[model samples]
Target: MKYTEEHEWIREEDGLYVVGITEHASEQLGDVVFVELPEEGSEVVKDEDICVIESVKAASDILAPLDGEIVEVNSAIVDDPGKINEDPLGDAWFFKLKVTDLSPMDDYMDEAAYKKFIG
Candidate 1:
């Protein structure tokens, strides 16, 4: 898994990259109330805003971690936004992308570095 400074996590599985906010981000956001996810099959560029998350404290955009086509979206979070606060890294993953080029995955921080970064 890799982590971005924006508090998003990236995990590659079966050729797709799964994206979700970190535990720290979930806590910071408070209880999640709403989620707006992008359509499946849509093309996305790295760093583009692709999803929205609303919490008791604030609303935030979830950025595309790499250029790719959105292969799948987890609508479960939309129906039950509180799931994000409950399990951010697992069942609360926002979406998965089928990136053609994976070189940029190298640019993100590893778990150890990300912990230090937040510190």
Candidate 2:
């Protein structure tokens, strides 16, 4: 799992990555109400906003962890945004990307580093 300073995580498996908000982000956001997802096949660059997660406090942009094309989105979150607050690291994943390059992952945070950052 790789993390962004913005509090998103990207877990790479094979050549694809599953992206979601970190637990800290969900906690900070208060209560999530809506999630806007990118369309499948849409191209995304590293650090680009690919989705929007609206919480009771404010809407936050979900950034892409690396350059890639969106391969799938979890529509369950769109219908029930509370899932993000309930299980941010499990059932609330926002999207998947087919990574275009593995090199950019070097810039991301590891689990330990991310935990330290949040702390």
The most accurate candidate by lDDT is 1
Question: Judged by TM-score, which candidate is best?
Answer: 1
User: Candidate 2 lDDT, tens digit per residue, 1-119?
Assistant: 88889898888767679989999999999999989999998999988888998999898888888888998999999999999999999899999899887797788899999989998
lDDT of 2: 0.90
What clash pairs does model 2 have?
Answer: none
Q: Which stretches of candidate 2 lie over 4 Å from their true place?
A: none
Candidate 1: lDDT of 50? 90
After TM-score superposition, the amount by which residue 87's alpha carbon in candidate 2 deviates from its true location, in angstroms, is 0.7
lDDT of 1 at 113: 97
The clash count of every prediction, one per candidate, is 0, 0
Relative to the true structure, candidate 2 reaches a TM of 0.95
**TM-scores for candidates 1 onward, in order:** 0.97, 0.95
| RMSD of model 2 against the true structure | 1.0
lDDT of 1 by residue, 60-100 (tens): 99999899999999999999999999999999999999997
